[model samples]
Target: MSTPARRTGRPRSAEADRAILGATRAALVELGWGKLTMGDVAARAGVAKTTLYRRWAGKNELVVDAVAAVFDEHLEAADHGSLRADIEDVVVRFATLLERPETKTALMAVVSEATHDEALGARVRSAIVDRQKRLVLVGRERAQLRGELPPEEDPAAAARNADLIFDVIAGSVVHRLLVSAEPVDREWARSFATVLLHGLAAASSGTGTAPAPEPAREHRQKPAGSV
Candidate 1:
């Protein structure tokens, strides 16, 4: 008897990855979350259905990764002089990415599902939110170097601040564009940055000082543990 040929998946290919993700996004915009399927994506991408199955277990996982690829581009920011300028540049780019048909539709679908599915929610946080938060870290470091924001002495506080900053920026933008269905124009980005870095009063009247990180207080070492 002749030995049977072993079935094997196609070797991983960057070209294939690009084709699949691109086709998935395009299909998402056309067929939407409810209608899109792995078979259809493989057909559109011109690859074997097994290829998509090997790469992604299901449509939800694939869709999250596809939309994440769009949101994740904010990681590559160009130097825009002041911290405020950087903030404005990124905000506008972020808003534009959200406005893409596939990004909006896929992201909304996944997020709505994520609310009830813990695993999906965790995937969204790890693959998308956590990765993009590096933007907050980078911007904060630059601001510190330029004396725009005060240096944070407490390591724990620094982490908390970065999380809070990202939450505020991401939350406000998502609400304005997706929830309220308002335009996030350049003017809005500029104004939001001003309010974020400075306070509401400063953004409006230009009088209050920008809130900087509080300086760490000095302790006298507790006089060698004398309580």
Candidate 2:
């Protein structure tokens, strides 16, 4: 006799994936990477430890996935038909994400783990590089399309300016969060964008402006509003 047909059905539940990510983020915030345990994640997720393990190889993998999920959820590329609008949108969204206590805590946890975990470091670098590259490319292309950038304007320089915008914001936020300085909010991001854009536009116009200021130190500090 012929065997019965195998069952065909819809894929896994989206709710479950969200639950796992949510639980993982919560656990990281509460316990941090060193103290976080599979049991804690399972308890927060309201699922069995076996289930959590089945979905992720270990705490590192879970943390990586959680960070990726948070980025995807919060950071969206803005195509506002103009470079300025796009910059504003991205800067605002970035500041908003940094302001989130859960996101900040989770980021610190992942960054701390990356100090010793080579694999985790690679994952973090890949995520950051790819996202930054995408933003720069999109902004540069849009600026070119709008004829805002001069014909002789270097695409690489324009793209690098986009990267610099993020660097400034990240540096300022890190300074506040780690050193207990003033918060890096929307205003700071706007100022960064304004200065960077002014320099790039000046370069394109063939009118040299004052030399840019020296970059700040690499070590991060805690901002006023950080948890």
Candidate 3:
């Protein structure tokens, strides 16, 4: 068989790509989704509009990637030695991200539009929701290792439980922050983690009363910065 000819083109700059995404986030913060434009992002990124379009299909796609990047930046798992502590810690971190005006605004806008747009929905699922779910998996694995949770006889059930936990954690935080227009702070996170831990304990023991979860310690986090 004949070898195919090598394609020739200049390589895209990774630095420029990071700059563009950072610019998109800045635009969202300053102008919001409605007011933001390709020209604005290009100028903020110090790149041509063509450069952005060359990388991303449109504003929606670009914003999705930008939001995903921010989420990735904040998605961290700290081994706090106990399930309750770990859950509370991660929940506080997540709530911190939710509290950000830029992330909150952009995510809700994209999600609202995603209801009607299949491609956007897929992007949000793959980029945002799925990535965040890893927090649940990691926590679950840690809990099992510590004997905080019982071993699963069925892998399918374990997966389902993880999904349910993810939904409860993420959905409650979103609803409280966006719909209820309430703040998700340390107290709220600890309470939520308490309820979650108790439920998991009951499930594992098949009993009405479970041991009280360890009190969650305060987590001091730094602010997110621009690139």
Candidates sorted on TM-score, descending: 1, 3, 2
Clash pairs of candidate 1?
none
Better of 2 and 3 by lDDT: 3
Cα RMSD for candidates in order: 7.6, 11.1, 8.5
lDDT score, candidate 2, position 81? 75
In candidate 3, what are the lDDT values of residues 167-212, reduced to their tens digit?
9988888898789988887777766776786765465554534576
State every prediction's TM-score relative to the real structure: 0.84, 0.71, 0.83
Residue-level error in angstroms, candidate 1, position 85: 0.5
- In model 1, the runs with Cα more than 4 Å from the true position are 1-10, 206-227
In candidate 2, what are the lDDT values of residues 114-198, reduced to their tens digit?
Answer: 9998998888777654565566566655565555553325668766776775666556556665568465566655554555667
TM-score for candidate 3: 0.83
The worst-scoring run of ten residues by lDDT in candidate 1 lies at 215-224
Q: How does residue 46 of candidate 1 score in lDDT?
A: 99
Ranked by lDDT from best down, the candidates are 1, 3, 2
